[model samples]
Target: MIAWIRFAVSAVLIVTGLVSFAAGVIGNCRFGYVMNRVHAGGIGDTQGLFFIVLGLAFGEGSFMDILKLALLIVFMWNTSPVSSHFLSQVEYYTNPNLYEHMERK
Candidate 1:
């Protein structure tokens, strides 16, 4: 019974992660703005990968596997934001027209 429950939960989590990834892909193609595309892809890369790794950890049900997965998640959790922020900074510094969209007081 416990095994079956674990399997079910793991399956659901993996599916949800896949859906998030799909949404990110779709969003990247759908959005016109550079920042928007980066945000969309970053959401999928971080959240989707986290969920997938989490599901895999649950399925493995071993301390070592879980530890490794946790490390991977932690690494990604830290890096993804920094990367997205860097990209945004690059766009802001390079794209002179960015301010055109803003209203002056």
Candidate 2:
């Protein structure tokens, strides 16, 4: 029973992570603005990665595996936001037409 519950939880987490990633991809495709796309991607990247890592760790994971996943999550959490910020900064500084292409049409 406990094993089945664990499996269900892990499955749900993994599926949710995949859906989040797909949503991000859709957001990127639908938006014309670079910053918007970056924002969506960053959010999805972090959330999906965290969810997937947690799912993996929850499924028959030893302490060391969970520890490693924790570290991985921390590393990715730190880097993803900073990279997104940098990308947004570059777009802000380099793109003179940054605000021009934001129409929803």
lDDT of 2 by residue, 1-105 (tens): 988989999999999898889989999999777888998898687999988988888795799989988999999999999999999999889998876776666
At residue 57, candidate 2 shows an lDDT of 85
In the order shown, the candidates' Cα RMSDs to the true structure are 2.7, 1.7
Per-residue lDDT tens digits for candidate 1, residues 1-105, read: 999999998999999999999999999999878888888999888989988998898899999999999999989889988999999999999998997644454
Tell me the lDDT of model 1 at 96. 88
Strongest candidate by TM-score: 1
Q: For model 1, name the residue pairs that clash.
A: none
RMSD of 1: 2.7
CA lDDT of every candidate: 0.90, 0.88
Q: Which ten residues in a row have the lowest lDDT in candidate 2?
A: 96-105
- Where is model 1 more than 4 Å wrong at Cα? 100-105
